[model samples]
Target: MSIEAIGAIGAVEAVEPAALGVPAAPVAAPGFADWIAREVGQVDATLATSENDLRRLATGQVQNLHEVMIHMEEAKLSFQLLAQVRNRLLDAYQEVMRMQV
Candidate 1:
């Protein structure tokens, strides 16, 4: 390809707001509390599903024991992870509270 053709091919096409002196759009980032709330909410949903499975098994309406066990394990793991995250956050908060500042 000719130099001019190559130059055209290499030309910038991506949006460049600063190049045209236009301000970029604002983007909202999730706060730490929001992130923690989402994690807890997900774990709560898993636990609720596990509870339903337990209820079904108690009522002799369970389809598969294996599936219930899997759900129980999944719920257990999610709860454990969420609990650990919460504990760590608490510890961090306590540490910050102890700070001189």
Candidate 2:
């Protein structure tokens, strides 16, 4: 399924930065921006579903606490993955800036 479909299934809402009155950063390329946006959307959807599952478990709507714990761990792993990616990007930018012209 596409990112949008997954988001819809998870009932995740998209918030535009501009709509929130935040200035948008200029993307180096449209395709790159779209790819990043899709990944972010997927992460957001997963986190939302994980949170909902925890809520359900807390309210006794769900029987298995293990499932909620698994989802929470998955979200944590995804967040770590995103953090690594960000770190790598920052390192690359720093390397480029330090290059002798």
lDDT of 1 by residue, 1-101 (tens): 58898889769688799789998888889998898888888999999999999999999999799999999999999999888988998999999999996
Query: What residue runs in model 1 are displaced by over 4 Å at the alpha carbon?
Result: 1-21
Q: List the residue pairs that clash in candidate 1.
A: none
Model 1: how far is 38 from its true place, Å?
1.0
RMSD of 2: 20.2
Cα TM-score per model: 0.72, 0.67
